[model samples]
Target: MRRITTVLLDVGGVLLLPSSEVMRAAIGHSGIDTTDEQLRRAHYAATAATDANGGPDRVEVYRRTFAKTCGVPAEFEDAVHDLLTDQFTGYTWQRVAPCAKEGLELLLAKGFRVGVVSNSVGTIEEMLATAEVCQVGGGPCAAVEVIIDSAVVGVRKPDPRIFHIALAEMGADAAETAYVGDTARADVDGARSAGLWPIHLDPYGDCPDPAGDHDHLDRFDRLCDLLTSRSGE
Candidate 1:
């Protein structure tokens, strides 16, 4: 509720998306036909399903939900899941989200301090740079204050400690910071636990928030608007 000045984003679903080529290849191999738009919707839905399930087998949940959302027949879902399991890698998440760079630029232009806090395998910084999304310092892309990878920090999200690390690095106050991410279990809960406002990037309206607790953004432009409005308050 406080005026937002600092924004921390999750890398995977917020700025970087799964490679369309990789997803299409996997779906094709499974004999399922899907358009690029469908694949994008499926990715968000899959993450929502993972948040709903909240099980230890997150990868399996995500793949299965993705397969189902891609229109794979129930009988072929397992096969598609298997195919995804083999094909989906950390490198497969290389596509920068549409308007991601512009969104960051808009935030920075509006005087918002931006940074990344992702649950990844330590390659996110390079991946973001290669994708031309954002980086820790000045470059072709937007310059963020810090990039916190869970693997590098030895702490994962849904853990306030990880958010604290980013906050400390940015010299940001939790009340005036917003954490934007794609999952409820990890992003919303973790940010709330860390005393930061949580904003879920639910582009497809797939995530169910019965409590109506956190903010939801359907697009990057909406994020710019939300933060600008909050800062004005």
Candidate 2:
């Protein structure tokens, strides 16, 4: 697993996420009777299509992937895509993921340099502040050293340049850092390219790839456990 001094995380799925109930409702409006579990699976699958050209066409990428994964017909694809995009982009439809604060606090407590590298729409930093992420948790806590946003930086995932930007900002080397994200193509693919160890936050273990190709975490809080076990090994 190599030595890890810095821990970088993706914001959308790892910290801020669309409300599951809202997503279900949106998909239901398109006449698809899907469960929250299905929506989540589709969500992870959809994010894979988000690549370097992820800004303006973000909604379209997610739309196609989600509809296909959920088996939505062509007749309802447009409607479902619109509704899903509305849910993901609108702040009113987004909520902080559970254990996000606790996980960041744990990483900071363990002396890890933490930062955020997100493919965002220019408001991620503000959103993180609103969610109270990476803030002082009653006492001293680890602060995020940098936030590399695709919108602001003009570089998106699947391009190792973005990750390198973050590593440079943190004054850390790629081998000493680990990037945790939800999307396989964008996060894991990009992190590995930038020479950082990649960890996928796959709570449901729905990754289509074979097991053991990359480290996986079912929960954010469990990251501490993985790091602890690795250091001991």
In candidate 1, clashing pairs total: 0
- Per-residue lDDT, model 1, residue 53, is 87
**Candidate 1 TM-score versus the reference:** 0.96
Residue-wise C-alpha lDDT for candidate 2, range 1-233, written one tens digit per residue: 56678899998878877667777776777677887567667777776555423567766887778777877888888887787766756453256776788898788888888889988778777777776675322423337888888989999987999999998887998988889998777888899999998999877676666668889998998898887677564
Strongest candidate by lDDT: 1
In model 2, where do residues sit more than 4 Å from their true spots?
20-25, 30-42, 48-61, 64-77, 90-93, 135-142
TM-score of each model, paired residue for residue: 0.96, 0.80
Clashes of each: 0, 0
Which candidate gets the maximum TM-score versus the true structure? 1
lDDT of 2: 0.78
Can you write out model 1's per-residue Cα lDDT over 94-118, one digit (the tens) per residue? 8888668788888899888998999
Please report how far candidate 2 places residue 96 from its true position, in Å: 1.3
- Superposed model 1: Cα runs more than 4 Å off: none
